[model samples]
Target chain A: MNVNQVVQSIREKVAEGISEVYFVACGGSLVDMYPSKYFLDSEAKKLVAGLYTANEFVHALPKRLGAQSVVIVCSHGGNTPESVAAAQTAKEHGAHTIGLTHNKEAALLNYSDYSFLYEWGDDSNVKNNPMAIILDLAVQLLHVVEGYAHVEAFQKGLESINGIINQGKKQVAPRARVFADKYRNEELYYILTSGASYGHAYGFAICSLMEMQWLNAAAIHSGEYFHGPFEVTDKETPFILMMNEGRTRALDERAQTFLNQYAEKVEVIDAKELGIGTIADEVVEFFNPVLFYSIICVYREALAEVRNHPLETRRYMGKVAY
Target chain B: MNVNQVVQSIREKVAEGISEVYFVACGGSLVDMYPSKYFLDSEAKKLVAGLYTANEFVHALPKRLGAQSVVIVCSHGGNTPESVAAAQTAKEHGAHTIGLTHNKEAALLNYSDYSFLYEWGDDSNVKNNPMAIILDLAVQLLHVVEGYAHVEAFQKGLESINGIINQGKKQVAPRARVFADKYRNEELYYILTSGASYGHAYGFAICSLMEMQWLNAAAIHSGEYFHGPFEVTDKETPFILMMNEGRTRALDERAQTFLNQYAEKVEVIDAKELGIGTIADEVVEFFNPVLFYSIICVYREALAEVRNHPLETRRYMGKVAY
Candidate 1:
């Protein structure tokens, strides 16, 4: 299915659960919950969103589940054991459950109350970007709750999405080129980002470098860097800053100053505003981390191009144990 | 400041606040407040100890700064900005403040109404280890609260410590021997621990690795792990589990089995009952992160030895920031 149809279907499905929503995910499935949590906290404002690791839902946090809760189970392959367990657990506990998956009949779909099949096109055989679709669905859910996002506006938003993707594709070209020029040279690599984009920055940074390139990379809070991490950050071993307009924190200057003292090269994503900040900033500066992440994705894409590496299968991220 | 004499002095001074106690600190200092809190929770059962991030004591926490409240600030350098602010803020509002420090004339000592010096010998030049005297002195203060940390028995316990330290030192000896050791070879390291030992585990596992090794390590709750971070672990990149015998957590073993499927290595510390489970385990467990940290330190020490390098005090791992 094209992105537009995916948008329409997800909106209709999400609108059904305006009161209670639960994100049931394991591993990276949890990261997909970020946008939804942010969307709930921002858009619907009233949409109560909670996270439960698929297995822990039965043991500890499952008690927090209310009858009104709509459990959203996210598994890439729809076969992860804990994801399977979570699906069972939520159903057993009498919660309405939905599944967001790339595969339709991967066992987990059987337990799903409603399931969405994200068609990542040709990339489905390669690195599946269905997790991104999950975010779109969550955003749609939030919009339905807040009366902000609708079929027309969201579709328009989706239409505007392509241009930015193209822009993001080009935006990170220079750094990708520079880093590509220096790829196998460095013995160590580190990435740091804070504010709202941190979880995404940390996750994306890891999966990008380690999953694709098989490099050792670390991510942490930017401010906490001064507490200790800065000592190893020197000219010979520099670090990367997720210098996107990190939500509410305009820490680029302070971070840059400290980084400039040690880093050999400091790259900045000068995209105007990429983060989906608090509801207040959403009206003003809602685009920082997303665009910045897209830049990183583009950089990763470019690196794949230069290295003659095939695109990574989502399966390359390994699997979740039950 | 021999360990024995130093231990005695700190014990005598902390007794000055036996009626009611409040442990105040920020950052790691706030973390060190755990044992005292646990002690009050279990033994003193009557003393009512509250551990607050010192700065909050003046505002939301310490409305009653009367002499009844004994605020013990555990700071490595004894001069954290917030801790200092909290000390001043507490003293201005009439709370009796105590400073625990290695440096004699620290700013925190100036603000403290009572000061206990943990002078661990001439540890100034060597950034490697603290003077044993001070650590023992800090241990002594625990006795004053409820007269439970029997000095005579603990002195014997101190003798056994050398053996445990040797075990730790020996366990990590091989870790440093390779640039590509099993632990450091990974793209990420996550340390998880709980109960009384959480704060130290959190600090040492997360902070120490970042400070000394520049590795991306995430340290969090053992129980909390299943809720979110557990989803990310696969057989290739798994988490390090800190296992100790205390609370009956059926969930931990289940979580471990899941992680074992995907983990590169599952490092375990058997901090089980030694008959001293009540006090020593609580304190040692509360400081278990430090114990585990001490192991990491030796691991790095071995690494430095094998690599013909020195323990790079990149960020002064123990240095407090004011």
Candidate 2:
């Protein structure tokens, strides 16, 4: 199946599997999976946890699957050994399964009761990961728990974000240029965000900092920064705070004012308002990382280029065996 | 009044007024308060969360607390303007207040209907924050939870930790001599630990790196590291792993072994078991940051001295608000 069709299919599967979920993914796939899960979890009535990696799964054995459990596995390449083993272990313990994958080596399709392919093996621009679309489809599917109107609205939000991402490519790189110059001698950054967008900020900060800038970075909820990271904020600290276009306006206003109090150098990325036609904040929540953070990747890329560092290839994060 | 008696007084005053709790505190006081609330939440009890800081209390508004809420404020100095303001805000909202402070103008005490203080005041240190004990006392009084044995053990553990910190001073500087030389050029670090100790690691790493080393740092649960940070692990990466005795030995073992696989250099500090008459790991959890991370500070100090850079100071994390 082509990526678009597979993306549509995963959403249907997630909607079907909403009653019982056991997410098992690692590295970049796990990081990419959070946007969908964040939406599912905020609205979900069932149990959910994002496991760290496949190797760590053996430790959680006594909490094994029953007839109700459904394991969902995501791996970009399907070559990582432990993720494969983890899926196998879940099956051995008697759980139904679904696999989302692009890699041929993935044993996930073999082990899973149902599977969706995110790659049609077409000549695609490697930069735009279709897997993100598939991931959102899963979130869109499970959002049916809240009912169909919500799910349909959520899909349209994803499409709106896809449009934004396309438009952002021309403008993002240059806006991020100043940051590239200043952070040359800098080695760490902190990002503090909130609610559904929190995971998006969290994912982008870590992944972009690691892959694009080769810099160590951290992210926390805006409230949590006050709890701990606030004490350390000083003139030299680099901080980025995300602001929502709607829904979180008060929180956004407070966080921006509060964060600016401590950080010497601060950057605020405010989400552009969509004029609220049909894509409400809730439906569009999963796309914040795409809409808000891809612009950040431009800065990150600019920073790397100025430093003469290639977009550091991530050989470790998505090499999944499952 | 004694800590328990003061707690009883607060509960009585609060019973006549508010029923819900929203705790606000910092430093050792917050640390002690967290455990009971954590345990209570784990036990599936319904109680509003302790915001952990006055700064946070004003911003997050944490679930449900209003006219009939109880604001529990703990601060040794009581003078921190924000803490004082938080208690005042809650009182303005018609809340009952409980102050656990070492001094009256320590701000919190002035606004409370009831207050708790230790017989010892200025003499208290991180190892003996009167505010911590009093907060613990308040939790027990309010919850009617009995764990006198655990209290006795923890106190004894604290006492032993004091002695170990004293003894450790002699050994740490010498070992630190090696690292201070190497880490001088590094500007970032990532500390990973496990279990409840993970929070401690997160706190201490932030405090120390910002306070003494001047290196920007982040901390995560050791197992949780593989979930996100492991993909970026490499030679020349500044990695510090915590190996204190706690709930999981497997995590520490795995993290250390994996550090060998990916890290250019790894620093391991074996903490002394806390309390007398206990095995090393048994007591290790009590005051592990002091035990294991003292070497890190020493290393930083050695670097500052050798490199002629000023030692990083506790500009904001220490006793004074300035």
| Quality class of the docking in candidate 1, CAPRI style | incorrect
* Fnat of every candidate, listed in order: 0.13, 0.14
Error of 2 at A235 (Å): 7.2
> Which regions of candidate 1 deviate over 4 angstroms?
A1-22, A38-49, A52-59, A121-162, A273-280, A283-287, A313-322, B1-202, B213-267, B270-322
lDDT of 1 by residue, B1-322 (tens): 4434543544455445534556676544555556445434434422444555443343333333455455667667776665777777766756666677767868888887766665442222221223232234344544554465445654554455545655555654554454335444554566666555555555554455555555556565564455344544555663556554444234456556666665656665444421224335334433343345455555556544543445555443445321
Candidate 1's TM-score reads: 0.58
Positional deviation of residue A154's Cα in model 1 after best superposition, in angstroms: 9.4
Per-prediction DockQ scores? 0.10, 0.15
How well does candidate 2 score on lDDT at residue B146? 29
Q: Compared with the true structure, what per-residue lDDT tens digits does model 1 show for residues A1-322?
A: 4433544554465444445566767545665565555444334434555554565454334233544456788887888777877877777766666777878777788887667775554223211254445555556555555555343543444435445645555656776787766764543466665544555655554456545555445564564555555655556664667654424344444566777765675555555433222213333222344445566776667666776655463332354434
Compute the TM-score of each model's chain A versus the native chain A and list the values: 0.74, 0.79
